[model samples]
Target: MGLPDYIPVKGSITFLGKDITRWSITDRAKAGLTLAWQLPARYEGISIRDYLRTGTKGCSERDLEESMDFIQMNTTFLDRAIDKSLSGGERKRIELASIYLMKPRLAILDEPDSGVDLLALREVLGLLRLLADQGSGVMVITHREDVAAGCDRSYLMCDGRIVLEGSAGAVKRYFMSQCRPCDGCEVGEVMRRG
Candidate 1:
């Protein structure tokens, strides 16, 4: 999640009240900063359990079982390799499961609602809520109207900048009136109004 290019270009990233703008991705992860990517990378031969034990602290089988249950995955997932065989939704849930095991202080999710069905979308939202309830800060990068509306606050980014920030309803209304009519917008770009 801490890829070099992903570093902020303007403002700094403060986590747990500490400035982490200069920290390496590895350093950030060690400090309880975790992310679940939308298009999770495939690990051709890594079993789920082995991959998690390497990435998460205290990731014993028991922890995996508990985390898997949170994501609605059965224990059988532990034995499967995180390869192309698993669907995108499965991979996204598994990544979230790994993040849950980390008990991260802040969780950054990138369009987690993308490429998933409605039922899975609910699981993703529930996981975000659970992380927030656990005292972890949750930052979601999403375009889904419902997902953004479920947040306490929301930001609307345009051209790599935050064009609007407020309650989700306000941002959605503004986007509809201001951005939705732009000729450059992809037909699929509008937030799916809930």
Candidate 2:
């Protein structure tokens, strides 16, 4: 479902400079440009810090420190354990930090902030802005209004297709207008998942 075509059938997905649709999942991930699954993987013997360092080589203490602070602000479980002991929100942040460490030219995050609380969402939003500012094109697949609003541009998907493409404000207005109780409706509802 993370591929350009989410048809649930055999297909190809290219990432970074590689055409990974033909490669093994592990091989493709090593090439940079990757997806953080909705559910984070658990490695019983490894600590969170060690797990990150495993995938990101020669990672500076400063980078890890910055990432730790960023992850902690957005997720409370990162500094905790990975031994089936972390909460959903915590796991999500860990996965996000791992993805951020990959530092791909293009990042495709699917429902990146799904399990997080409000404060975490704020931190994630700031991080996304920072990534965009650093010249990375971020494609955030989310239903959250806050996520969409934080983006430089947004694409509205309906019926498994893109229904609208424009600045976030335009998309928000189109959604709000189509909804009932238009005048009192909260724009945030646009991004909320069930």
Most accurate candidate by lDDT? 1
For every model shown, what is its TM-score relative to the native structure? Answer: 0.82, 0.69
Best by TM-score: 1
lDDT of 1: 0.74
Per model, state how many residue pairs clash: 0, 3
TM-score of 2: 0.69
**Lowest-lDDT window of 10 residues in candidate 1?**
185-194
In order, what is each prediction's RMSD in angstroms? Answer: 4.4, 6.5
Candidate 2 on 1-194: residue-level lDDT in tens?
33333354654565655567678866765664566544566666666777777778788766766676656643333455577666667667677677667775666677777777787778776776776676666777766676777776676654344567777778878877764432422223222111
Q: Relative to the true structure, how large is the alpha-carbon lDDT of every model?
A: 0.74, 0.63
Candidate 2 local lDDT, residue 26: 68
Clashing pairs in 2: 143-191, 144-191, 145-191
Q: Model 1: how far is 149 from its true place, Å?
A: 2.1
